[model samples]
Target: MRPLLVAALLVLIWTSPVTARATGSVLSGIAVEDVAWDDGTALQIHWRTKLDEDFRVLIVREGTDGLMDTLGLFPANVQWVVDDDVTPAGTYRYRLSVFDSEGILVFTAASHGLASPHANWFHRGRLGEALIILGVFAMILWGTFRRRDIYLRPIGGLSAIEEALGRAVEMGRPVLFSAGWGAQLDKPTTMAAMNIFGWLASRAASYDARLLFPTHDAVLMAAAQESARESARIEGRPDWYRPEDIYYVTGSQFGYAAALDGIMERQKPAVNLWLGTFAAESLILAETGNHIGAVQIAGTDSTIQLAFFLVTCDYTLIGEEVFAASAYLTRDSMVLGGLWAQDWLKIGVAVTVIAGLVGTLLDWDAIGGWLRGI
Candidate 1:
């Protein structure tokens, strides 16, 4: 009877719950959401740590098999993580396990999720940006119809054009225009150049001063001739238009430069307008014009060539001033509207920057992070 009682007591000791402590819950609120703007291979995991828990949270990713693979380890304070190493279009499961400092499992919580990345037509994050763009476009159209006036700082180069042409007339010498070797009719710089040329030709014809346009491309020559002809007709001096005044030179860069240099030395043009695209040959042409005592006005989009024109030419259009030249001369509504819109945009940017700066100092992370992805 003593042996039977001892055996029964041993069995109770082995099976008793009084010796084992239950594991405390360490994680909660496990949620998974699909990631935006990505192929179907990722999901975002969000979770919360239990109050007063001091443990390492080990996030494990499980597949269809229900077997856990350790994704990452973080402090219990971490609330969110992204799991990117997922198979496309495949279902997945996640388990958030907590471990004590001694590496013993404390508690775990799990959530099941699956995401197959599909391309979305519109990114939810960019919705605000799209609205702002639409708003700006509407503003531009409204201002255009309203004939909103824009204030432009007086550009000395643009203002000096009339004076230069007048000096050419007084000297009784021809006004020379070169669009440089790279001035093709299709390029924006060259197109602007032609527009300015049309204006210049009009003034020249009205003053009865001769004008010449030398080009490296046949197409540009034809374009220049038409521009001159149209300007003459507009000024009621169709007979003043001369095809020989707008002619093609050698397409070879240096060859064209040499020919123009000879013209400068011999013709001694009173006004030299070097506008549009140029190259390394810019310095050479500009130097010759400077030596000939010609009043020079130059504009170009070339970063490297601009330095030469800036110093050598008596007046130079900096940056997009070349593009704005036509608008200033003609006052066309389309260009004026665009310029007004641009000015307003600049103001908006300045205000946004100032506001963002102030907000950042005050701990408003949202405003400052606008357009950060840029």
Candidate 2:
């Protein structure tokens, strides 16, 4: 009985399929998660291998009319496979096989499941996109709560505003203000104009000096006129708000400047404030203002026109300073918060740039490579 049992055990060991030895290669922890979409056509496959071996995946479609397709080859132990330009939406099966330096030998654990290409916005954007969205909101809110006054370096151009207004009062001449082309929207440029103009117009009333406000947009012109009138009333001098002075000029760029040039020649304002965004007509207005002997103070974020303002205007606001002007003027909490946040960001940027420069000089790749990746 013991001999018969030993023979049966030997037969079971020799004949059982599970006793077969690996054919010079092996695949262990094979897995496939949910498929990911690539564009409108492709799909991404994620899997794991037990051993490191060179292998290729062959995706097969199982049905009565079956078809087999060799997907592509990838490194052994590779955990991912991306197949692009796949056929239209349908259920399909997939499998992976192991290959050697010579030819294909070992097979991977079979993956027989449905692969359907479905359309979805969440999939299009991805589940993790909430991270970016939430991060942006957090930054904005963080800026608002951590609000602090930004240490602004002195700007010669912006500082000239008071000087110009004072000069106009001393000279007994009207102050001219052109509220740029797109000053209607409450963007940085337009907001700067509102704050600066409100202050200047009030001072002009106090000095008993004339103020001329030219408008390119009806809405902005209306707002400026009302604001100036309201400011003059606040100063107990509503009569100083002249409706004709805030009259509508043509919307055409050249036409507006030409009309303004005529006014500058005749009225001869002692001070000119050019605020908001300007274009090709900037130099034309500046040159005219200069010719009329107006002490010009300009503020803009337009890099293209900065040089023009620098050459022509007595004072010019540059870049972020224009954006920070409202916060500086109003001292509002939320605006100050944003300005402080941006200032910190700017400091971070400056430090990164300085670090990169030092690292580059030392032939170090740490900072340089990290910046390149970003």
Error of 1 at 364 (Å): 8.1
How well does candidate 2 score on lDDT at residue 74? 64
In terms of lDDT, which candidate is strongest?
1
> Model 1 lDDT vs. the true structure?
0.79
TM-score of 2: 0.58
lDDT (10s digit) by residue, model 1, range 1-374: 74463344334433553232224444677888778866656778888775334566667677775554566666777788888877665677776766566644566667855534344466677788889889898877766665656667788887888898888888889999998898888998999999899888999889988998888999999888888899899999999999998998899999999999999999999988888999988888889999999989998888789999999999888768888788787777777776777678779989989988898899996766766863
Model 1 stretches with alpha carbons more than 4 Å out: 1-140, 148-151, 352-374
Question: Cα RMSD to native, each candidate?
Answer: 11.8, 12.5
Which stretches of model 2 miss by more than 4 angstroms? 1-153, 182-186, 327-338, 352-374
Clashes of each: 3, 2
- Could you tell me which 10 consecutive residues in candidate 2 have the lowest summed lDDT? 56-65
In model 2, what is the error at residue 302, expressed in angstroms? 1.6
| TM-score on alpha carbons, each prediction | 0.60, 0.58
lDDT of model 2, residue 16: 51
